[model samples]
Target: MGEVLVLTAAAGVPDAAAAGVAGRATRLAPGAIEVALDRPLPAGFAVPGVDANVVPAERRRKRLLIADMDSTIIGVECIDELADFAGVKAEVAAITERAMRGELDFEAALDARVALLAGLPESVLGECYAERVRLNPGARTLVRTMAALGAETALISGGFSYFTGRVAADAGFARNQANTLLVEGGRLTGRVARPILGRAAKLAALEAITAERGIGVADAIAVGDGANDLDMVRAAGIGVAYHAKPALAAEADARLEHSDLTALLALQGIAADAWVD
Candidate 1:
């Protein structure tokens, strides 16, 4: 398993950056190149618009994909948008930020935020989904491509099941798991169901989902953007932080700051032209 540098940039790998490569670039797409180097990446070697990952050509593609829903797959945090109906967007979004950054306890933060939504009509959830919730760039390509390649895909979230169920169906995820929001008489009870699905449950779901596919944790790739996703992100062999929170970006194996969710496909040696719609 020699070092392979995959750079995604317009000017491509500057001659200075590919100093130790033993092979020529096999262009995966515009601005993306794969070069096998005789030696490992040098210390502090980095280029702008270039994402360098040293992976074995054989183990690049993963058999399982576990992804976080909010701010990773979808563009907005569902809870924050739903809170707008209750006129508590600022209050709930603040908590959502802290929870994602790892500064606040996940379950407690979720409980406090949901408590603020008490008494809002449950129909607002639908409105928020239709108008506020949106798929991030490259979300479908990432999932559809992996699923097309025989990988098992799952959407796991600390968000409510209402959104996950819809997103899973719309995005073609094989399965999904999430916290259930309690509603009474078409209005939110402002309470989450018992045994809230938090950080631990996410990690557990990762393990369970992969096991069903007859693969171990090392064959899985997990992507997320928040603190609650930290555990599972680290648990997978390929943990990616997609436009992530500071804590998650610092801890995950790779950070996708510039590219969309489809960057995950590049990490797995999939070319842009090969991506599924």
Candidate 2:
């Protein structure tokens, strides 16, 4: 199969840095390069500070975009924010840290954290949405550009649908999927709906959406920063670990260490000038 190396940076990758790398190169952006490989890129061949990908020519631009919400799209962890409202931020955040790091089982950790918010006023959900939730940089552009091109965008998160729904609408996704939080009489029921949407659920969502769109997982590009996202991330044609945890970043096909979410666009050959509003 044909191959290409995309080298990208937030600050810009210089021409000198492109030396000794194989391929006939074109600049995809001020900070990105698209190198048409004469042969496969050497193992361990990497630039000092740019994100690089050795992708097949046919897999360059994906038709399906499946993204993870929470830390991937939004700036804060939804549970951690709710924990803060419940006066258990430190305790819950500790579990969140380990869970994301792959040190703890995600489902059990989510259960434990959600349990700490037992009896919290349901109004805090709206309060957290209004006061603490903010989309990450480049979130809108990625979704808009993909949708504008006739590709489908879906936001699947391990977080609650409450936030995903709002984020999906604002970020321009065509659909969204997330777990449901059980609430009662203006307070948390100290429980979430059963069959929690953990790692397996994320992969299933990706599969179901790709099938609906008449594409395989290889036609989709998935991005996330958590351990529960590992399956979906690895299954996608292009899996990105965006400011990710150690376990994920170590295994993902691409790592967005320097660039923001828009970097995914550059990776797919979409330039800033061509980005949709």
- What C-alpha RMSD separates each model from the true structure? 2.2, 1.5
Consecutive 10-residue window with the lowest summed lDDT within model 1 = 8-17
lDDT of 1: 0.85
Give the TM-score comparing model 1 with the true structure, all chains together.
Answer: 0.93
Taking all chains together, the TM-score of candidate 2 against the true structure is: 0.94
Tens digits of per-residue lDDT, candidate 1, 72-153, equal: 9999999998888889999999999999999999989999999999999988888989999878877898899999999999
Q: Score every model by TM-score.
A: 0.93, 0.94
* After superposition, candidate 2 runs with Cα above 4 Å error: none
Candidate 2, clashing residue pairs? none
Candidate 1's C-alpha runs over 4 A off are 9-23
